[model samples]
Structure formats: structure tokens, C-alpha cells
Target: MSSKLRIWVTGASEGIGLGLLQHYQNLGWQTVGSSRRTQGPTVADYWIPADLSDSADQISAVNQLMTEVGWPDLVVLNAGVGHWATADESARSDAERVFALNYWAPVEITRLLAQRAEGRGLHVIVISSIAARFGQQKLATYSASKAAVALWAESVNEEWQGSAHRIQLILPGVVSTNIMRHSIGRDGQALGDRAGAHRGWSVERTVRAIERATRSGRFAHILASPGVRLALIMHDLCPSIFYLLLRRKP
Candidate 1:
């Protein structure tokens, strides 16, 4: 692994992506951060602009970068949107939008990169949520979308079994970020205030874990917080009990 490896971070304008960029920069790594709206810090050697939701634009952005900077050693698919809704309250359009960004977009980008970097040592990092481990009340759509991403990563990892490219899935528990404030709820409301109360891991802590995992070349699914790890173990040990505890109150 190169000390000054080139990295591409999607959703780099804020949240975990932004924190990761800052941390990597501090470690003297060259990075390119992408976002749909805000431009990333110019301090980065390259800032490839992109909107993951826009498939054509995202492909073009990557092509442009490859023409200029060659293929990135690591690509962090960190951009995502969360929407929570009860099964009965969820709208078709809401589910469509969530799947488009949270699942399809990353899958498309990963496919494109894998095809282009056939024999290269490429690492693709996916930022899935711990909610993916099991369905959550009022978070059906979000959880399902994350589950799709996680399963996709697992499939891709298997497909690249004898290849140099690798896929990594990161399951992060609740983090104090603007994503909570922006996440849509069952009744199309924001969960900003409510999510703040569910304390788990800090963005810095998750970012550090991501860096460590990437450096260690670990391809297995990773849980960023101990709470999530414990929850997963319990869920596996006693599914009925776990489901009962996770059931939503009416």
C-alpha cells in the first residue's frame, strides 16, 4: 500500500465522508472529494465534482478523473440518504428515491470501476448502516435499502474472489451528524431531534475504524461500534427475542 495513495470520497462535503477526508489529509494521503452541492475543500489535490444520484453525471465524473489522474487506489462510496417509514405509511416515490441513491447508485459506480480496473489493486468501501442487520420500525425503507447495499457488496466480494480488486462493507451505528436531521421519517417528517438522543459512535471514531480496516486489507463486513456488534451477536443468538425487542410500539 502506498503512503500517499490516491483516494476518491463521495459525499465528501460533510458527515463521515468529510471527516474521513480530513483524517486522510492529516495522514498525508492525496484525496478527491465529491458532492452534489457544496464543493469540497480546495486543499485536496483533486476535487472531482459529482452527484451519485445522477448516474450519467457520476460516470462522466469518473471518466474525467481517470483521464486526468488515472484510477484511484481506493474509492469510498460514502454518499447516501436515509428515509424512515412504517410499512403502511411508506410511499412508492419515497422508496424509489431511497433505493436510487442508497443502493442503485453505488452499485452502478462499483460496476463501472471494477470493469475499468480489471487487474489493479482497487478497494471499494461502502458505507452501509447497522440498521441493515435487521429491519427497524419506522425505518423500513432505509433499512431495506442498506440491506440491499450490504448484500450487493457481499456478492461483489465473492465475484472478485481471485482478483486484485476488493469490496468492503462498513456498518456504522448512530453517529452525530446532519444526516439525522435530514433523514425523512414515516410521516415524511425529519428525525433530527429524535436521532440526537440515540448516542453510539462519533464520526471521528468511525472514520478511524474505516482507515484501520482499509489499511489492514480486511474485506469482511465491519461494525463501527461495539453496540452494533453486540446487537448483531444477540440477534443471531436469539432472533425471536431480538425481533421482539426491535418491534415498534403502536
Candidate 2:
């Protein structure tokens, strides 16, 4: 058996975060899970509740985890929401709410963990989206927020060049999750039918990739699907072409 590692997974009540929590716990690692609500699985060692949109609550939750678990060997910032709104119909409040949880909250949590885990072999995993690679008509805000997160992870990885601590960005394509089912457009219209087919691997496959990447500790960024990987490369090589292809109506 592999040596158990102390791990913390945010947004652990459901989706990728919950899957990771279960996987690690089954691996004999001590896992701490956090979510805004109390619907998380019962396997985690600690379930800290806090609203990620509130800075104070986020900080308090982290502090509470630190007090009880010291510093986690791995911290996965996997809690996020998806919003699709036309530029004009998207309310300012809606955009801000999305940024709060998807971008700002993760940045704050990672910053605090980086400081607390200094000198330790800490690995921070950020679950960004393939949307960051190219622009989608109605998902402008969501794409931008994820792009910010991916960029932030790259910057932090650069900063930790000579240190033991590392940051990994997991950019996943559309997966089977409640986020897709519950997505709404700027006009408060349901985008469920427009979500398109699931393109790549299952959530389990992505979780396995994360586990392998975490163990290998070689790649700083992980593209969850072949399509997303290709899109990312294309975006880097020929952004115009990538955008043109991604701009098709869903």
C-alpha cells in the first residue's frame, strides 16, 4: 500500500471533488472535505462547512482545517459553478457571484494554503475548465473566470520553481455533473439542452488522471480529455482558428 497522505478537497459534497475524496480515502489517506452544505459523504475525516463566496467564511474554514489537520500534503480547489449568459442579459450580480466562487475564492484559499504549507511538500490542485482555452458565446464570464484560475496556477507554479511545493491545474472538458443540468443563461434560461454530448472520459477517468499526476508530480497542467488537449494546443498555436471553431452555437 502507498503511504497515506493528508489531503483536503473543497466542494467535496459532489462532482469531481467528492469523487476525489472517496478515492483518496480508499487509498488510506486522511481526507478532509469541505462544502457549503452538509450533503457530503460520511467517509471524510472532517467535513468543514463554509460558503466559498464569502471571504470571511472561506478563511475561517481554512483556519479551522489548519488547526485540526495542520497542513495538508495535497489541497484540491475543486469547487466551482458554471454560468452561461449573453453579455447584455447577464446581470452584474450574477457575474460577481460566479467570480466569487469560481475565481476569487480559490485564489484566496490557495494563497492561505501556500503560506501555511511553506517548506512542506504541498501540492495544490486547481480544477479549471477547457472553457479557459477558447471563448464560447454565452459562457464569456465563465470562461474568463476559469482562464484566470489557469493563469494563476501557472504563475504560482513558476513562483514555486525551487521549492518543494507545487501547483497543478486540471482543465476538464464537459463531464457528467449536476452543474451542467443546472446551468442557466444570462436571461435565466436553462442551457441544459444546449450542453451538448459528453465529449471525453468519465469523471472517474479524470479522477484517475489526477491521482496519477499527483503521484508522478511531473506535469503542472492536466487536460482531462483528448479534445480539450487538442484545443489547448491549437489555442496556443493558432488562437484565431481555435476561437473560430469554438464559437459555434451550442
Candidate 3:
């Protein structure tokens, strides 16, 4: 039998990253997990410990990852934080931190990984959000950051088409994650939300779509369920109506 494919996932500590890690691990992939901590959160074949919030740590982590694996067949850029700050309550630093993890970290690490590939085949999967498509309610910074990464993936797919890399931009609707609660919930808590999180999709559901898309050699996957996809479509087709519908209740 052929050797199992190798993968490296960032933000392997929890949520979507954790889901992907566990799935791939169970499938017998030669997987490596990276997070701020060296221990706990998961048991992978290998681990890459690096806090992506710091540039030095990021560079070190990438260097260490390349040293250990040379280049993984696939790199899942899934590490990010959830910020809960109102427009008046939020600070510039908070937004910057979100952007650092969500946008810049992924870009730099992916850049290093792509270059390391040296024209070999590579799959780059990014876990973005359906929130990327809409500027709804109070998640301005979070929404913007997700949108930024999605846009970056578009440009990357354009620039690297004939090269070693193919990018997967996944825009998943609200999943039952703490990060989702933090991003969509009020007072930074879901509060048993009627704001649609109870009906939010599962991490497994989202990751399965990712797997399917990857197998098909596709570049984009929007894993929004029927209603969610409709709402997003409506948001695009009728921005004014969506603006009113998506806003929180008074």
C-alpha cells in the first residue's frame, strides 16, 4: 500500500482546526498539528508549536515546520482568534491582533510553504467564514478579516495557477464553535442564541465539504447550508433587505 498523505494544520488546538486534525488523523494521515502550546489539545503524529500572534514565533515555527517535514502535501491555515468588542469598546490593537492571526499569519506561512514546495504539487486550504460575505451587526472587524483572507486566496489562486500551489478558500456558515459564539454572540457569549447559532452547522459537516472539494481539485467551497446560503445570496442580491434582516433585534 502507498504511504498515507502528510498534512500540517495550524490552530490545531480547537474548533475547525481540531476537527480537521482529528479527521485526518483518524484517516491515518501522517499529520502534524501546530498551536501556541507544545502539549495538550490533541495527539497527532507530530506537532509544531508556535504562537502565530508573534512574528518571531511565526517565522521560527515555519522554519521548524520546514525542517521537520520539508513540505507537507497540504497545509491547512486554520489558526485564528475570536474578538468581541463593540465599535466604541474596541481598540485599534484588538483589530490588529485579529488581522495578524487571520490574515497576515496565514499569508506568511503559506508563502513560506509554497516557496518550500519548489514547484512540487501543494494544496493550501484556508478556513474562512460565511461572515466574510456580509457586513452584519457588530462583527465588523471579524467580518473584514475573514473577507480579507478570502480575497487574498482569490489573488493567490490567480498568481500560482501554473505553479506548485492550489488554494482552497472555504467560507463556512456559522458552526457550533466557541469562536462562532464569540463572533456572533452578544456580550461575547451565545446566551443560548435564537440568532441562528442553535441551527448552525457542525464542524464535521464543514470539514466534509472541505474534503470533497479538495478531492475534486476545486478552488472554492462555500459550505453554507440551504437557508444560510439563501440568506447570503439574498444579502448579495438585495443588500438593503439583508441589512435590515441580519441586524440584531432591538
Per-candidate Cα lDDT values, in order, are 0.81, 0.80, 0.78
Q: How do the residues 151-187 of candidate 1 rate in per-residue lDDT, one tens digit apiece?
A: 9999998998887888898888777778877687765
Candidate 3 C-alpha lDDT tens digits along 1-250: 2277888889887777888888888878877888887783555777888888788888888788778665677888998876655676667777887899999988888877766776688788888888799875567888889999999999999998777668888887767777744343334443243343435678898777777877877788888768778888898899988888766446
lDDT: which is higher, 1 or 2?
1
* Global CA lDDT computed for model 3: 0.78
Name the runs in model 3 displaced over 4 angstroms: 40-42, 180-199, 248-250
List where candidate 1 sits over 4 angstroms from the true fold. 1-3, 186-198, 224-227, 247-250
lDDT (0-100) at residue 210 of candidate 1?
A: 89
lDDT of 2: 0.80
Comparing 1 and 3 by lDDT, which wins? 1
- Which of the two candidates, 1 or 3, achieves a greater TM-score against the reference? 1
Error of 1 at 237 (Å): 3.1
Winner on TM-score (1 vs 2): 1
